[model samples]
Target: MTEPRTPKWRALADAVRRQIEDGTYPQGDALPQLKPAAEAAGVSYETMRAAYKALESEGLVRSVKRTGFLVLEAPGRRRVTRDTTVTRDPARGYIFPAAARPDEPWQVHGRPFRALVPAPAEVARHFGIEPGTETLRRRRVTSPAGEPPFQLVDTWISPAAVEDAPQVAEASTGPGGYLDRLEEAGHGPIGWEETIRARMPDREETQLLAISTAMPIVETTIVGTSAQTSRPIEVTIRVIPADRVELVSKLQRARTARWPVAPVKPT
Candidate 1:
């Protein structure tokens, strides 16, 4: 018996996928119309449409009515190095290079969403406060220009921290942003602990991130402690679209190393 031939639509889809992967038709580029593509590929118009539909299902392209199919900027795998060193200035509390880069390609916009709600059990534990304590929550959606937001960060700070400095609760917190205000209020962060996990996004997250349900999300929890007092002052939860960004950490081996220790016998 002879082997079956590949479907025209599948072959067309594979060719388009290769072009996208090789940057021949870069992200945000519009693809040829179904009729034109069909003529060029020597296939029926319906076959070309099927190929485009396959690409859409794979998250490579999206079709807009009246408009042609547009390529999507599918996030490629990247290793984002985590900086362990804490760089601070008297004028500008803590400087995080990864959080905000001055020379980024895309423009960043931070929109604040404020709420005063009781702290959850995990949040309270991180904040070193009892559950149900009324906390000032500040949520910000950071996005690249003309694109879906990259991350949603919810910060919970003690009411006392923002008591003297009301600007901390406001939407616009000046040039230095929230951390600067916190430092001026005498609750600058001296140390922080971060825990990262991967999970599926909820409905609200899917809408805000503008991502499909199949996409996974990266959740990072950061707890910041006061410099003056060792008490926890801020707890921030960041939700990152896994397809858009990657988290990387670099660890150094200790200089004093011992090798080839004898195996321990039964105790």
Candidate 2:
């Protein structure tokens, strides 16, 4: 008898590629997230994740920490490399104002996008809603110009947020793109919290990210909250290829009163 089919992950990855090529998933459309796809494909979640990693290595799928996988380029789109800078200023704060409606094309030197439907568990856990609740999810890969993808980002928002901010519901063709609608609706948060972890990539991750066997992945979980209420509104997960990516943060107090009181001296 023929040897058992090469593990399910490879098969699943190939199937997704096939779907994308045949226009089943379509450009700008969300593909199924991992759990459901694994169940349908009759494989374990680990196996499913493996498949996605393979696609990622081939530059077909991108993994975001919190959001699921996303398809950045069309099935047959060509990727041309140019010397570019993937670094952002940590000390300088940049905001894409709501009114400008700036556009960033998907083919920028760094940053690739992956989109997928939310699974029931993810919807409930991430958005504080019941299973089956609807949401829009995207994962982004940001790398330094002429470097490997250094950052993986996953983002999720309630369907209501999308419905209210119709522009955000639309697929971004590039970067600094969706924030406009969120800011316009006054939903953008002033601060975010991040959690970090370190781990080695599995077989699929190793292949898809084209990472060396020795490299570890630095995983981060980020939650954005309203400046006023301090309530969490957005959650992001990012996985950085440890060899090529670095995470940077800068904190600035908004006012004097907001600063902590100093110890008193004896009168």
Candidate 3:
């Protein structure tokens, strides 16, 4: 039996993927028009369009209406390490020690918006409250200096946790941010749990992140509990662009003494 030939679009997509991987179309480079690429690949215009769509789905390129397709930063190059440890400073609020560097100082522009909307099912569960229960919500977009936004965080706090500290609902929560305010309100975070997921962006997310709908995104849900009561005090949903950042987890194994060498046996 004769072997079946691969689909034209599939073959073209493979060729483009190779070029992207080999840095032929380096990051931020614009690809040729569909007609030109189609001629070069000796395929129909529709087939070339399919190939571009495939690249977009793979997150290798993005179509910008009139601007055509542009290469995206490869996943391997841009990484933002996230340490398991959560440290707090008297001057800075919550600090990710792994992400901080002296040369690239981080800048935060918080645009806090308050809402009394019903909590999402997952958020309600984390807060141990009934679904659709009204809660205080603060949405913030945080970014680093000279770069696009790092993440979008939507924090939901139980009314009891922020009753005494109304400032927590505002954009600027003094020096220590919301955690400090919560501490003063007698609901400090002693432990945290985070869940991470990867998926495509929604319409609003695409615009906010300045990315195409085809790009993948990382969604992290963080729950903070009180040290004294072990009750959930805060739940935050953070959305990060996959191309701009990477997540890392560090673990340290316990040390053990070396065992004595045994006599060698002939095989």
Candidate 4:
């Protein structure tokens, strides 16, 4: 029997994977656009697109808007080490354990974007209001230089609570950040509850994080609730690409259980 022939898309993907591994296209480098790349490989545009999709699923490359496809380089070197714990300092303001981690050099994509915008459905639900209701949304993006932008943080504040704390809407919510301000304004002793979720990102999230739609994202909604009254002060939605972060949790045993009598063996 004659040997089976490899499919065009797989062949192209394998070739590109090899090139990426061999450093032909360095990390953060954009691969050729679809038309030229497909022509060069003597494959159809659809074949090239399929190959790229496969590579994306493998976490090897990603589609970036306006920049074309980009090499992810290596996950090991880019992987961010994280701990499942929140750290805060009254003197230091936002102790960023999330994105812009202290271990690696990072840059805030831009200054915090402060605006009073209609709440997203999820955010509105958290705020106990109808969807599209006006709310104060503060946005920030943090990432390492020369890498895909990751960790888009959107903080939706309870408008009523911040009436007296005008600084909450300011460009810079002074020391200890807005949380501290809210606490000082009678929302004191803020407690946190986090709901973690994983799913494929939407178009906006994909472009913001510079990842392909094929990749999943880890979304963490950290809610700051009033410790005394149990009312949420703010809801923070944090988004990070799933392939690049290593989440660590240090679990501890609370207590030991012992049987009162000897255990019986099953037949």
Task: State which candidate has the highest lDDT.
Answer: 4
Candidates' TM-scores?
0.63, 0.45, 0.72, 0.81
In Å, residue 208's CA in model 1 sits off its true spot by 0.9
| Cα misplacement distance, residue 21 of candidate 3 (Å) | 11
> Which 10 residues in a row give candidate 3 its minimum summed lDDT?
253-262
Q: Residue by residue across 1-267, what tens digits does model 2's lDDT show?
A: 878767667777888899878888764455688899889888898998888787766655565546677664422212322221222223323331111112432223334444446535743565567776556677665543444444455677656556556665556523455544555567655465556689877665554554444457876666656553455555666665654434343555766657477667999
Over 77-175, each residue of candidate 4 has an lDDT whose tens digit, in order, gives: 244455556677667665644645455676677676888899888887777888988899999888787565667889999777668577899887778
Which runs in model 2 stand beyond 4 Å of their true positions?
Answer: 1-116, 119-124, 131-134, 173-176, 202-204, 212-214, 227-231, 245-267
Ranking of all candidate structures by their TM-score, best first: 4, 3, 1, 2
lDDT of each: 0.76, 0.57, 0.77, 0.79
Tell me which of candidates 2 and 4 scores higher on lDDT. Answer: 4
**Tens-digit lDDT track of model 3 for 1-267:** 989999999998999889988989898888889999999888899999999998988777878778898887653335556667776677877864343454567655545577888987988887788999999898867666666566777889877677766887776789988888887776664578888899888887776665668878989888888775688888888888777666675655544433465557999
Candidate 1 segments exceeding 4 Å error:
1-73, 76-78, 88-93, 97-102, 105-110, 128-134, 144-147, 256-267
The window of 10 residues in a row where model 2 has the poorest summed lDDT is 96-105
Rank by lDDT, highest first.
4, 3, 1, 2
